[model samples]
Target: MSGRSDKKGEMMMVQADTRIVDVIRQMQEQRKQDRQIFYDIYSQQEKRQDPEKKDTGLFFFRGEKKAPFAVVCAGGGFYYVGSVHESFPHALELSRQGYNAFALQYRTGGAEVACEDLAAAISFIFSHAQELGVSTDCYSLWGGSAGARMAAYLGSYGPARFGGDDLPGPGAVIMQYTGHTDYTENDPPTYACVGENDGIANWRTMEERIENLDAAGIRTEFHHYPDLQHGFGLGIGTSAEGWINDAIAFWQAQIDES
Candidate 1:
């Protein structure tokens, strides 16, 4: 490891082999200035009613102030949260593109539980959007694998359907390598990407999703990468690299439509 002076004129450790976990750890260590973590977002009634609600939270990786944001959920097959692989890398890339991004930690029993936490996280963000210096209009929902299911569900059914306030659906939904097949004509504009060799989530399933979205009159873009696997976060050196830029372009188009 080596140390270098950052823009703040403070020395920071530089890792020779940088990884997404390293970036996220750096952000966590520098949370005082780099990231904001919101803890335990249950409403007063829910907190009082269900005394055992988990303490999952949201980690915000900010970009341009007042920019529309994307809420990213990582995949863990409803058992764990893979933020290191799926959330932080995506958020970091989105931030690099000048978009505010949040990586959410949801209760991981299943999609239903995870979606509830996502809904609460979105509600929390919306409630404090002004203070957070983010615009609520045309924000995006991004997820990978199981998390993609959560994002897709919310994109199809607004927050209110999942016990949150009746907030507008995300302007765009970015899904990566998930077997999410459900769709509606009202689904937000979607950008989907999958690897031809993704054993976990079939490329054909994603193709079907795109077909359904297109048939239903939803604006969508689908990319099929060659020789990539399920959880290729940020794509790094893989064939799926640079997909985030295309997703951002899709999101910007949605904002323009708004």
Candidate 2:
């Protein structure tokens, strides 16, 4: 890493459990192939109006043209955006599986601001779907830790609640390692996973939420991997390894039902 790359890497709280290098390599490959990997969700005028929006954008990992898309948000406890460790890799994997994927780079500081950025990002993608070559239908939202709360909030209340346009929420919401318990009767179908040993976000909290969703007659799936801890991006090589596949299936099931 050097220059801007090094600067970006410095912002990441690199952990032994994360595959930051792999994400960097994949991003490099995408750039080498001449793909437009990043898109500013906010226009220049918007950024000028609110300088905080300058860091907000979407990093794309393209799949089949016009295929359904997903937006992945990485968690950093609202202090930083961990897209390299948590989101970019997931988007790359999703693209490999033939789904257009985007890793969101949102402004950090507070939950409300983050959710607003997410809503704005969703609106940006929807507005540019045709030019971006992605289907507006059956799109999903994914996130880990604090980011999971953002996804769930948007899933429950919708983008309009967060200052975005009146738009349909995701067909599914995939959450990881978060203890968010909020829900609404109209929340999208949801799939969630957490590590039982996660000290920051107790697995019981997640399980209880899932149970509540089920009791409310909402489509849901929950998984808790024993002995694993928090921030296990992709859970690769752990008991939670391959969990993303299960989540993908859950999302697909929602699409089928819809």
Candidate 3:
């Protein structure tokens, strides 16, 4: 709430149902500005030779007037900045479809220890929902690969470095080739799998972790395109459209149920 640029309010419109096309335009502009700000900040820090200054950027998309918002987390190996060209498009497309979309940025690799950056971002979303124009009550996390792992950890109410008990878990999720834990009796959580190919498919070690959450009646939808690989959710290389479509449907289904 403190640092949110007054500029955001200028672009936001209280449109009916918050259309996707208009939202994407605003989100893209915001993303560009945020990235540039971070880039320059890092540039200055680099000149100063401050090891504490991180180059990883922070950018979040915005929706129209929707109470519940959809947040997108881009996957980076806890090692590097996630793909903006690849991951952010999902936010744009979702905004076009009438969902407030945010493509979040977090510390990458071991920048701030291990996963502290991601946890901080999650906590920020929860604690600052009012400023972000999102409902603290409902959140749907969409991520692929490392993003998926982070999302799953946040969604499952699992132990996070920042802790999210103050923030409600995602109402629904779209997991594609995620990796957090083995799909076992205790993990791999069944309710979240729209299991694509590889990675999250660690069923051999734990027989589909998603089943457990599904059994608990959590709102979850699974989609699989065996032709896909790790970063399918970004809608990048092969079968990207399939991943987007499936994720949208999953989100829609959950929204309907609510």
Give the number of the best model, judged by TM-score: 2
Backbone clashes in each candidate structure, one number apiece?
Answer: 0, 0, 18
Candidate 3 lDDT tens digits, 1-258: 434423322223222114345445665676767632121113454437745445443455545664566656666666664545335666767766767666666556542332344455556656666766666554677676676666666555532534333544566656656545532222222233333445644432222445455565544455555443344344333344455776677666666766
- lDDT tens digits by residue: candidate 2, 159-202: 99999999999999999999899998888889999988899999
After the best TM-score superposition of candidate 2, give how far the Cα of residue 53 lies from its true spot, in angstroms. Answer: 0.9
> Residue-wise lDDT of candidate 1 within 69-188, one digit each (tens)?
999999999889988778877887787778889999888778887898888888988998988889999999999999999999999998888887889999999999999898888999
Error of 1 at 224 (Å): 0.7
Q: Please provide TM-scores, in order, for all candidate models, with all chains considered together.
A: 0.87, 0.92, 0.65
How do these models rank on TM-score, best leading? 2, 1, 3
Model 2 pairs in collision:
none
Residue 165 local lDDT, model 2: 90
Model 3, position 178: C-alpha lDDT score: 56
Best model per lDDT: 2
User: Which of the predicted structures, 1 or 2, would earn the higher TM-score when compared with the native?
Assistant: 2
